[model samples]
Target: MTNPCASEIFKELSKGSRNLTDLTGLGGIDIFPGMLDLFEQSGKFDYKIKNGNIDPRLGGKTDIINGVLVITLSNDYLSKATSLSVSRTIIHETIHTYLHKQLSYYTRTDLNTFELLDKYFKTKYPLKQDYQHATMSHFLLGMAVSLYNWHKNFGPTGGTLGFDYYYKLSFAGLIKDGTSELLDEAEELIPPGSSWSDIDKIIQNEATGNYESKGEKCK
Candidate 1:
């Protein structure tokens, strides 16, 4: 039950830098609004944006309950993050919805396998509600940011405007304050193969603006 739309959005967004004029034909953020529309109309989920303090660690979350998928984004995130960064959050939550839906269809045998994996994660990480899947989500966020940086030509950290840049700056500050342990733990779980080095190579290869025709290899 792979989500082709999600895959396609990732592919398009991975293309190199473009301006508003460049957004018209394709390979631009314009596709985002349409994708959101499609997802909403599909009747599989309801989306909500709330303004309030969300858990500082989470910008967005997706929950599937009683046959309804609910995607919630923190109001603080909406108020502070750049449009592109917010779009990335939306994309992240969409993928979560897709993955969760895919898992819900699994047979009991598959459920057993997932339970075993969960137990293994609990034994290995000793963390509650945070483990491999969280790491995978971070990796996905990395994938999204890498694509964004490449496509938008973000300088060093992120474009001058956005939570992406602010988040990186905040990371540095967190380190100075001796509170980066959580960030460090999250960074450590970026799946060995999907390391930033791998993403760097991807950016280098697509520097020539050839990503439009490329298939997603990060997943």
Candidate 2:
């Protein structure tokens, strides 16, 4: 099947700017049912209204009672936001969910080596600062997300990535603190003899080292 977001391609029409404070066309992002499916697949995001008022924060929310998603917004946002806002919102939420799912995977690995690491090393050598470790999965997943965002906002080369509402990350060089060679670095980590099948499996799968998922001990 075609990509779910395919129909909502921004190329079909121009998306004038829309701000979060101004809530018009905000509901437009929900036009693609799959987009909703994508979001739902991530966690528990429910449509809710209570006490006679719509929640106004786009800040992320989690359903503590059941472990799900619940982002709140106003009717004005649903009615007045533009396509750009909707697209960015979907992309942003999708990233959050993807990370959650992968962490779940790591939490399940039962390798003994992983158990040993968790028992003896992980806690002892815990993060000392910015000196942190990244799973291959996290790195590549980030690369993919960054690249897709680049495409969504910037489109193809000679295309635009602006939102007039909020900044959509564009080319890497635009960042104030880091180099833009991230994509290149992630791609280079591919195993030398790996095939497309190798690519199909989790990118973070390493020959050694166990991973933690959902705060559970895993390998």
Leading candidate by TM-score: 1
Cα lDDT, all candidates: 0.38, 0.28
Cα lDDT of candidate 1 equals 0.38
Q: Kindly report which residue stretches of model 2 are placed more than 4 angstroms away from their true locations once superposed.
A: 1-54, 59-74, 102-219
Clashing residue pairs in all predictions, respectively, total 0, 17
Per-residue lDDT of model 2, residues 81-146, tens digit only: 333333333334333334333334443222332343343235533421111122222233232333
**Per-model TM values vs. the true structure:** 0.40, 0.29
Point to the candidate with the largest lDDT: 1
Model 2: weakest 10-residue lDDT segment is 168-177
Encode model 1's per-residue lDDT on 115-189: one tens digit a residue.
533653567555423443443333333333433443354223334344233223211111112232333444553
